[model samples]
Target: MEFVERRSGISLWRQIADQIRIAISNGEFDESGALPGELALARRFEVNRHTVRSAIASLAREGVLRVEQGRGTFIARHTKLQYPIGRRTRFSAGLAGQIKSRGGFLKSHVTEAATGHVSRALELEPGAPVLRLERVSSADGVPVSRGISWFDAERFPDFANRYESRKSITAVLNSYDIEDYVRISTRISAHHADPATLDDLKLSPGAITLRTEAVNAEVAGRRLEYSHTFFAADRIELDIDHQAGTALP
Candidate 1:
């Protein structure tokens, strides 16, 4: 730890977080090793213990450090578990609930629909309308995956507008009278992150990601949504479960 400039205009916590991230990347704190105590870091950085903890929290969310309540903060081990999507759920609700259930954090929002593979995946003709959304789900402050989801434009005419001010995509669909739907099918595959994907995911080159392509439809099979999500394979393991007589709920 080192002292940050008093008048640097950057928040103390942010400065601490930046330095800590740099330290980790530079191997100053060995990978999978324990970080300095909060008290010690505060003393060195000349900030409050709370500030140091906040910094630590930020790093942890980014998958840099692992903090255990009783055991202290350690360099995060390379381990990630993909929570199983065993049932039908809305994307916002599903990830938010799953993160809470397993001590993770989820940040999601909407973005502009860009032309490319996303349009095709959503089965929209070239330059057709589409909903663009992004999700960052993290465990212990480390980002496990960053997802960009797309939906057909014609069917969701105001999708982008609705999501701009709201966080719940499901609620937006509900507003359109799409009360319920089923996931028609999901296709899962693995590949190295493309340049854009890697940048958004904050990953090194060649990092593996699990891509899930899914189409959702109403009871009558009218297509409602289409999505492709890429999850960091290092931080999550997708668990597929099967049992007789259990429809996706």
Candidate 2:
């Protein structure tokens, strides 16, 4: 028997939907490739039949389950994409073989004075200027991650404009004559997706996200970029590569 947390700040139906999606991914229903009837699911989760119906409807909208009028809710072909994180992690390269199509676009940008955390991450004076960029990345036309990144405004003053044409972070950095950089440090955590991330990633309420905070630096050890990325946990898995060597302090 499964239980729903009434005080988890998540709607009961949403929790049910998220769990059903995970069970599908785990092949719990492979024998039938279809979900048990609403009444059975309600009994299993200790929810009302209406709640089970709502959960199934949400999964159907996400393309995770297909409902046949007379048959049942069947699993869709959705599968998690594997993404690798290493010293030289590149979004496009990481998803190359897992997906046929991949792309990312800048969602918004601003120039601002660096705050405490940003300044420390970028190794800059407290009030140094920085360019902040928000972006969303997709694989096979489905959003997989959303990221917020900061770069030294003094060095990449036209970073946003350059990225508009380059469409690739590597290419934009190349335009600045900085041919190489590497991951300096990375920290990861997991949490329930925030409302904004839920909408951006097309995730249902109560969905989980894998969060990564990282810093990148030039070969000479000058800080280049600092970013926070939120990946839809059900859609992608993070594979950390220890071969990247110890990151600098």
Candidate 3:
């Protein structure tokens, strides 16, 4: 309330916007919850309707709010569910543990010799056999992520075929005697989606996404799998936990 700054160097609209952002970050507005009405905010800030509108527009463009016609402006609330970066977990398994509601569909499977990135990740020759599985996961029917996973074909010749009907990649790995594997390293970054990614994830062209790249190895530290997953920033939040003594070996 009373967000306007008459003598500050910052513009009135910008000051209003900054305060609203601070409120959102501080949990003033619940995650994924509705925001105050424009007239209500205008009254509280002692500003004209146009001033409040401008502040809302700035926040919307910055991915802080989503304006739904007829419904109202809502806080872009997303909870970043952390997937353990130090332990090997299947996509469904990890997500199930983090998010109470989850769903997914396997998209495709490709079997070929590992090349370039895959080979380098697995520490094998460029032509080493590998199986790739593509999947799209969702929460409450909203697309959350697109994933591609690669496994050593020599170690799991049936990986591609068996995984087609399986929901848990860890189960498939277990069938191949890879009873346990741990995450070696996880890299995270933010980027906009390409045309293909946009189509697969059903995201707007300008939407932001979080990319996670992870490598997994047996207990002995022999790398066996690598995966890349892209998450829709608007729909889902990612959480990461790094407890002491659980770090990658």
- On TM-score, the leading prediction is 2
Q: Candidate 2 residues 129-232, lDDT tens each?
A: 99999999999899999999999999998999999998888889999899998998988899888998988999766678999999989889999999999998
Off-target runs (Cα >4 Å) in candidate 2 are: 246-249
TM-scores of the candidates are: 0.54, 0.90, 0.68
Enumerate residue pairs that collide in model 3.
32-77, 80-237, 80-238, 80-239, 81-237, 81-239, 82-239
* Candidate 3 global Cα RMSD: 7.0
Model 1 bad stretches (over 4 Å): 1-79, 91-128, 132-141, 244-249
- How well is each residue in 1-249 modelled by candidate 3, as lDDT tens digits? 455778876567777876775676567865557889999988888888898888888668656688999999998665656554436455666667656677787888878888898898899899988888888888666677899989888878778667766667777778778789887777788876777678887754445678888888888999978989898765555566565124432
Error of 3 at 195 (Å): 2.2
lDDT per residue for candidate 1 within 68-159, as digits (tens), equals: 99989998765445456533544434455445432222344343554766555455566765666666655555566666667776577777
**Root-mean-square deviation of every model:** 10.9, 2.2, 7.0
In candidate 3, which residue ranges exceed 4 Å CA deviation?
A: 1-72, 76-82, 97-101, 244-249
Native-structure RMSD, model 2: 2.2
Error of 1 at 59 (Å): 15
- Sorted on TM-score, highest at the top, how do the candidates line up? 2, 3, 1
Error of 3 at 50 (Å): 16
